[model samples]
Target: MAKLTAEIKESLAATKTAYFATAAKDGTPNAVPIGAYKLLDDETILVSDQYFNKTLANIKENPRVALTFWGEKGGYQIKGTVTIHTSGTIFTEDVAWVKSLKATLEPKSAIVMKITGVYTIKPGPDAGKKIL
Candidate 1:
């Protein structure tokens, strides 16, 4: 697992939305905008599934996912494997977190992503280069 640097963490926190990408077992691609995500630790991220249809189905087919976000500091693409939690400690925490943000929104599941790689998305010579 790759640990996220402080700079990358800050950038992720500053980002209001992230582009989440996933693929089916047969390699069909799907990408969606996500706003309910939290950095659980240096190597983990928690994402709440409020309105997921195809995304959840793709996750069931393939656990690999990529999250890309950009902010004032810079941009990065995070590649990881996910575990879905519908009813457990993680899901309970996700519910509380989402409720704190907005009581009206209900999370269907909690997606825990374990970081495997981090790459630069910033335009330059370092673009697409793996940093961790």
Candidate 2:
């Protein structure tokens, strides 16, 4: 697993929304704008699934996913493997976190992403270059 750099972490913190991409087993792709996500650690991210339909279904079929975000700090693309938690500790924490943000929002599941790769999304020479 790749560890996120401080710069990337700061960028993620500043980002309001990220584009999450996933693919079905047959390679059909799905992308969605996600606002509920947080870095659990340097190598892990927790994403709250509220209104996911195709995104959740694709994850069940294929665990691979990519998340990309840009902000004033910079931009990065993170590729990871996912584990969906509908119940247990992770799910419980997710519920609490989402509720803390807004009582009306319901988190159906917690998507734990174990980052496998980190790449630059910035333009110019190093675009798409793996950073970690």
Candidate 3:
């Protein structure tokens, strides 16, 4: 398990769009820009499955996922394992939040990822170094 620092949390919060990557069981890769997502806690992030098809299928076949976000300064890549929730307290909460943002947004499911590793993606001497 990895813990998210305050700086990382702030960057993620300010990020309007992030890239989520996943691979199918056969190793086909899928990466997409996710607009409806949020930090559920220090160790968890939630992504709404609004129009996910391949991403959802890949997640079900393989839980591993990677998220990359570029902020004003730079960005970091977060690697973790995801659990897809369709019906549960977390799902309900996520749906409500999505609805509040836009009543038209309907989340089919919620992808919850537990932070496992973090890496700096900012172009610098420390780029690609694992922070956690």
Residues 1-132 of candidate 3 have per-residue lDDT tens digits of 898998898888888989999999999999999889888888999999999999998988899999999966457899999999999899999999999999999899989999999999978798999998
The alpha-carbon lDDT assigned to residue 4 of candidate 1 equals: 96
Clashing residue pairs, candidate 2?
none
| Alpha-carbon lDDT, every model | 0.95, 0.95, 0.92
Listed per model in order, the count of residue pairs whose N, CA or C atoms clash below 3 Å is 0, 0, 0
TM-score against truth, every candidate: 0.97, 0.97, 0.96
Model 3 compared with the native: what TM-score? 0.96
Q: What is the lDDT of residue 78 in candidate 3?
A: 98
- Considering only N, C-alpha and C atoms within 3 Å, which residue pairs clash in candidate 1? none
lDDT per residue (tens digit) for residues 35-104 in model 1: 9999999999999999999999999989999999997777799999999999989999999999999999
Candidate 2 stretches with Cα past 4 Å from truth are none
Q: Which stretches of candidate 3 lie over 4 Å from their true place?
A: none
The collision pairs in model 3 are none
Question: Can you give the lDDT of residue 101 in candidate 1?
Answer: 96
